[model samples]
Target: MDAATSGTEDKTPHRFHRSLSGLGVIILTLSVLSPGVSIFVSGASILQQAGTGSVIAFLIGAVVCYCQTALIAELGAAYPTAGYDYAAIGHAMGDWAGATTYIATLINMPVFLNLSAIGIAIYLAPFGIPLSATMITFITIATVTALAMLNIRANEMLTGIFMLIEFAALLLVAAIGVWHAQPDAAVCVLNPVHLDNGVWIAASIGIIGIAVNNSSWALAGASQALMFSEDMKRPETIGRIILIAFLLTVFFEIAPVFGTIVGAHDLKAVLANDAPFETFLGQYLPAFLLKLVSLSIAIAIFNACLAGFVGLGRTVFSMGRTELFTAPINHALTRLTRRTDAPWVALLLLGTSTALATYIPLTAKLLLLSGSTTILTIFYVLGVYIGRRSGRTGARYRTPLFPLIPLLGVGIVIGEAVVLWLDAETGRKSLFICAGAYLLAFCYYRFVLMRRPGGWKMRGPDDIDALVARDVVDA
Candidate 1:
């Protein structure tokens, strides 16, 4: 296409047309969440920690997710940019915090692709697929990257289809688990406690973090959909779409988990197993159905790589647009092809991170270098708390509970991090590393990156507290 044909560049820097519908948003949210994998893996983590009462824990986590997304919706409205995580934080918290949070939170996105790809490998293992997990990951990355880079319409269509497959997979597990469940299973799972005792109570409290992690992991998909705010037809409706997505998360994830609890009727056994759903289902389900369900699980997870790249690519491109990195790389990362307006370079950069997913242990993937995100998100909670009413107002959406809600969000998230540290082995091992990462990223941003002309001009120090209070309201 020639210059005349291409028309003017989108002044919004790496813009995506608001072509994604409300339904597309829901699919994107669910797809990125990879509920198939989360349910099987994270559900077990919750069962191990909280047992049958895990449903309550998931509800609590959902409330937290609601508050976080409330703030996220406002931020998306204010910025209306791709990679809104950093963009909103940068605008709300300031340049330095934004830059650091952007780098720190990078780990969370990859796990979507990583875990989903991991699901693919695990599901196909029974068939003796010659491809190694690493090879499969690379192929997934390449394919998804190609589709994402192809066109927005194609990407949405593919994701929407894969999302339904995931739903079917979850349904298969939930239906089977519920149908074969013991008579007392329903009453037992709803019981207030699985093993009422001080030890169990303490364990449950600590496990709330894990439950919340799974809940958050599922909801995180909903939260991440804001990265494409520029692509949504109605920005305000993002909140509503997210709410619906949460309901789906509860149904697909919590229902199956509850069914597993009922079917197994062994709290200790569920807790000890990493994939209780798989274990119980395997016992009752015939080999053919089991293999079919396994394939569904893999396809569901495989969908995440596509959604993950879209999110991760946009985040990097957003940073690139601001010249967060050095010029040569930054220019490339932010560059857009005329044919598709896709961030080809950014997609390639994101593809590089797939290597870690194949090699790292799940605990390491979940905990190691993960603390940085919690720390930065605290800044986000605090940012929205203050940033909401900081300047001009008269907006379409604002989360109620105001200071109290955001304050509670900060406290709970911080509490989760601390609890993870004191209680979970994964938290203990990676605590210092996560903390050290925040320190390192901050130092680099302050002393190295910010000192450069590109970073200095784009995100000057004085602009940190500058208000983005437009379209935000008192209610």
Candidate 2:
């Protein structure tokens, strides 16, 4: 009859251990992002599109994301549940939005993990390594799956270790690049690639859409830390973890990028180079160390994929517990075990999907489309006004600039989604997939949930917190 231990007819919810610290939350959230790895992957477009304006694009992305995180902080402090954005939005809009958000997550999270893992092949190719992208993808997905199924604390430790390796590598690169700055490099860093010839093509400016897309992806995972709020030791600091992570993510992702180009006094070389860190290390450091740095790139992504696994497991479990999904799948997802009290079934579901995805001939464009579906979920911010108006007040931390933050966040996200839709590289078709997911969820909610009594209004943050408290007592 232990409600926290199983999926069977348990009136009480499964609970997360409060043994996690704020630092653990930050480490896990930042690992999910993998800034060092992400900047390299995302920076490829910046070199192609905005070039020197890459700095500006990254900063703009950060500011827009900051607004979104502000709203999340307020909601997270009030609710402090693993559901995070799912809960925040659900409370404001009702079952329809909740179900749609959940569906978007189930699609986007694993797709992101799978694509990022397979991307290891890009670095592997530069070394003349023999492994195909498919093989690398399979190996990485398998390894991370096994690792993700471990105890949450152990996973955190593993992520912490990998995160440190990447961050240290980034700092080393930044310091050395800054030290070896090429003449006029400082001035050029502030200019766009189009202006490199001291001339500008007004038409080329259109690609700011592409630059904006690259920068925004780096600062995502806004709701990830709060997804672990249930397991965190100090719930009060959950709100702060995101803001702290944002600052560091920018420093690591943006600074090193500009440093590498400026240090060499060669924008074209840096832009054309696929393996900037490896190239830099080879010239300034040892060859073996270059190989090690390449290995670290793979490891950083693998670690990040594992973080996605853990977050996906928690999210599915939370949705299932609240009966937001079908009973059978929810039954499977909520089957928690004392082994680590982890949601093994949900983790397995994600692992299997990611492993399967690794084999398919998925392009970066396709993956971007799949991942952008989650951008649809960020619209949940619109619910902030709805929640506040309905007396869901007294959050532990209210977002500064209140309505402006939430309103601007919703607007920026919508604009980005529009840009992505218009993107010749990946936008128009991805819009179909994103739209389809939303359509499916809305249909399901209308059919299955609407007729149910008291299903119209979803639980707000306080309501979710109360359930967790009760589950603790029941356990």
Clashing pairs in 2: 20-233
Q: Model 1, poorest ten-residue lDDT window?
A: 460-469
Residue lDDT tens for model 2, 174-198? 8877898888775665655543453
Structural similarity to truth (TM-score) of each candidate? 0.85, 0.88
State candidate 1's TM-score: 0.85
The per-model lDDT (C-alpha) reads 0.65, 0.69
Supply candidate 2's per-residue lDDT for 213: 63
Task: For residues 1-475, write the lDDT of model 1, one tens digit per residue.
Answer: 1111232432223455567888887777777777776776566666666766677777777777776666666555455456565666666656776777767666656654666666677778877889987787778777877777866667778888988887887877677777878887766655635444423444345555566755664555566766665567776566566657767776777677766766664455555566667677776778887788777777776777788777668777777766677767766776766776677888876776765666778777767545655665577576676566563211545556677767877776776677667755676656677777778778878898767765553331111213233233333
